[model samples]
Target: MVAAYRFKPVVVVLLLALLLLASLLSLALGPVAIPLDDTLRVLLQRMTAAELPADQVLIIEQIRMPRTLMGLLVGATLALTGAAMQGLFRNPLADPGLIGVSSGAALGAALVIVLGGTLLAQLPTAVLPYVTVMGAFLGGVATTWLVYRLGQSVQGTSVASMLLAGIAIAAISGAVIGLLSYLADDAMLRTLTFWNMGTLGGASYERVAVLALCCALVWWRLPRQASALNALLLGESEARHLGVDVERVKRELVLLTALGVGACVAVAGLIGFVGLVVPHLVRLLLGADHRRVLPASMLLGAGLLLLADVVARLVVSPAELPIGIITAVLGAPFFLALLLRAQRRGGV
Candidate 1:
């Protein structure tokens, strides 16, 4: 552990460098395929007001830049929340969806996609695009709140109860989403299917700003709970003995996770696996310390998502695969391997 601690700084630095390279690739790769130098030139010119080719400027500034930024924010938010959730649950396999926010958000987005034509017709055209985003965000928060309430009792918030409630809520939400999918028209069905798979294609400055704010709040606040999270790994009763406010920590972590994951789902649809996989990878290198895990997960998640997006773009050329599909392809095998390894070790 001491040796691992000594290498944590180096690991973080390497992850940061990888993230920087991934960001550059995200900006440069696509159907158009801007050269790395031109991508850098366009980025620098944006800051310094220097001249560049208008088309390159338009592509980088208007399209890829926002997409890249969104990828970073979404990836970091999901992975950070995942790390927090695992710490809260004292389980390595726990993820943000363990709280039901992802399913609730999906249900909400499904409603908007299937029903927006008539139900949202009265809304201004300018505001129509965001109705789904808002709905998903609100739905996620509402479900999390309901789960939190269900977990409450005379004994205070029970982590075991919350976990069960979250599973139940997620099931209910999934059922509702299935119903909506059944009712959707063919056009709506296609849209809903794509959205469910997730995309960064909807990236816009406005949406990125909203997500960035949520990510900022998460990044600022979650790390402050690092000590509490560390205590939590010792078990809640042990955490309380260590003077950690176990219930309050649980409440805050749940709320923060909802906000971060909700915003990502709202904007990018249902990209998965980042929250479940990235933190575990970080822990493999840096130990289980939240201080190292959280930050390292952030860097790695952002980088990995960006690389996945690059693959999504290149694999189909002019058309692109949904990023969620790419992540699922990558994560499922790793997840299975982890489970198998754990079983062999009698840890599962």
Candidate 2:
């Protein structure tokens, strides 16, 4: 019992250390290849006192740092949302994409990319990305709200209904995306394709700041839901009997998850499997207690994504692959395997 109490804080410390290591590695990596010592020096020179050579300064300031920080924030947000979703639904299969949010956000982003050049060009260039991000966030939230509404009824909520609604909404959103693609001109089509594929190439320190703010908000709300999540594990009816306020918990979790997902897909453009796979891995290693699982998910997700992004950069040498491709390559097989296992277990 003493060991059990001590373990959580120890694990949290270790995870934080791992995150710091991943952040340093991400900043150190890329095609130009700053040596680790030089990289550290450049970072220290920029953050503290001392002058650096122009070339090293440019590499650290103008290139890798923003992208690396963005990766850490994006990874943490997606993973936190994933942990929350799994806890809310009481299902290992639950993920951000499972609720139609990703499809909707992708559609919104594609629309903005495909059409914004002509329409939004009239507006200030500085305002365009913000407009696009707002559109995507709203679209994701809208679709998610619709799914929740469709799933709930006079008889009460059903997981099957929720899953079915999500699938239906996802199909509808996909069709919308297809239509948008068809209407797109050659340049717009190319842009949409690149955006859909997902890259951190567009990340800036400003965007990182915005993402961090959103993540901080979500993180603050999430830990308080731990007891609610624990009660949820007993099933909704039992949870209510245990004074869980099941409906309120569900609502809070849904909104928190949606906000986190919106922040993520807005910046990253539908990077897959972090949400789906990270929580499951966390549960497997750390157990299902939300107090532990939520924090663990954040660490594992950040590491997984940071590692994936590193692999993406190095895989093609000078030409970096899209981060999405790396994650899909890792996540799709695991997802399928989980689906098959669920079928065998009578849980699908």
Candidate 3:
């Protein structure tokens, strides 16, 4: 454990390096395959207000830049929330979706897809795209609020109750999504399918700005709870004995997780596994310290998502794969391996 503590800084540095490399690769590699030097030049020119090839500048600034930024923000938010949820629940396998946020967001997108043609037709054409995003964001927030309320009692919020409530909510949301899918026409079904599968294709500066604000809020606030989280790991009674306000910490963590993960699911759709996988990997490398887990999860999560997006882009050339599929393909096997190892070690 002391060795893990000593190595934490080194792990952080390595994750940062990986994030930087992933960012560069995300910018340079795509269907057009811009050179690394050219990508750097374009970024520099954007700040310096200098001239560059209009086409190259247009592609980088208008498309890939926003996508890459969105990936980083979404990845960081998911992983950060996942770590917080695990700490709050005192369960290593807990993820942000354990609160039903992702399923709720999916249900929201499904609603918009199935009904938007008629119900939203009166809205201006330019306003249509945002309807789905807003639907998703609101849906996630609403569901999380419901779950929180269900978990409340005279004593305080119960983490076990919350976990069970989340599971129930997720199941209901899944059924609703299925019903919506059944009601959708072929085109609507296709759109809904893609949205559920996840994509960064809709990324724009506008969407990125909203998600960045959410990410910033979460990042700014969550680390402050690191000590409380560390304490809580010893159990709620012990955390209270140590002078931590367990209830307040739980409230803050839930609220922040909802905001961050809601915004991410709103923008990117149901990209899973980052929340479930990244934090566990960070803990494995750096010990079960929330202080080490949180920031390291953010860095590693951003790098992992960026790399996954890269593979999604290249796997089929001009035709892209859903990034959710890429993450699941990469994450699921690793997760199963973890389960197997835990069982072998009698840790499960």
Candidate 4:
């Protein structure tokens, strides 16, 4: 809104280029370094059912590739959700995680980690593969619905009330998580503690497939609301006058955001900053149009997180820092600086 980014469509292409650059760099620069050309060769060989050096194939096909792919999907999900939320709320400060979705999803995952095999022992084996993901999705959707319902007053929807309700739900979920933590054994506690920071080290083909589905679901649904979001930017009455169906749009946006974020959180633990930062960066680079914002957010977010994952791997050599830490270190200061600038202009 403050300024137009020059040549919008080209910028989206450049973002895709950046994501490709990050992917190649990520595939090459791990603890066990593989040359970029060799990485490409290995990838091609795998695709064509050709043979390669066993060691090179093992590292690329088994380890780094899945992690990189998961990073792309999870990052895209968070950033897309954030962009959608900002569009819905008509504020740059709006992040998907600002609502209770991430916390609710985290709580659901914690429940599975703590009690799944024992307390949920009777659950069908076929359902176990997806139980955790389904739990997270349902939790997030339920929380979003509750917050939206609470925010609706006789006159209209209240952004303040929505934010406040989100805070309340987050607080309650945190308390429940604390209780779960108390009940967990050492093993469960260790697993639960991993949720404190996001990591993609556990990435697998199955997870990559699952997150791809979630990303596909999100990618399919979000851009459809671009026009409605643009209308809502003019305020609820104006959106209604423009035939935007404000309530339905809001419901659809919130649920879709929940679905995407919940699935990513379930798979990736709880990466932050992608949702909070990437969409803002996209808007600053590509303008406020939701159509441009959503897809651009996906590319930039994937690139940023892949870059972060590379740093996470290299920062400590043999030991890796959590991806969340890298993102927090990067994001926290950016957020503070943005806040300071906004205050100077009295936009806060």
Give the least accurate 10-residue stretch of model 4, judged by summed lDDT. 44-53
**Candidates arranged by TM-score, highest first:** 4, 2, 1, 3
Error of 3 at 310 (Å): 0.3
lDDT leader: 1
lDDT tens digits, residues 1-348, model 3?
Answer: 888888877888899999999999999888888889988988775544455567778888899999999999998889999999888877665686767888887777778768766877788756665676678777887888898899888876677788789899999998988888888889888777776788888799988887887788899999899999999989888999999998789878877887788778877888888998999999889999888899999999999999999999999999899999999998788778876886788764
How well is each residue in 58-108 modelled by candidate 4, as lDDT tens digits? Answer: 888789889999999988889989888878877676676777888888888
Error of 4 at 289 (Å): 0.8
CA lDDT of every candidate: 0.86, 0.81, 0.85, 0.83
Off by over 4 Å in 3: 46-52, 116-119, 124-134, 145-168, 185-187, 342-348
* Tens digit of per-residue lDDT, candidate 2, span 13-50: 87788887877778878887777887788766544434
- What TM-score number comes out for model 2? 0.91
Error of 2 at 146 (Å): 1.8
Query: Please, what's the RMSD in Å of model 1?
Result: 2.8
* Clashing residue pairs, backbone N/CA/C < 3 A, model 2: none
Compared with the true structure, the alpha-carbon lDDT of candidate 1 equals 0.86
Give me the runs in candidate 1 sitting further than 4 Å from their true place: 46-52, 115-119, 125-131, 145-169
- Which candidate, 3 or 4, would have the higher lDDT against the true structure? 3
Highest-TM-score candidate: 4
Error of 3 at 345 (Å): 5.5
TM-score of 1: 0.90
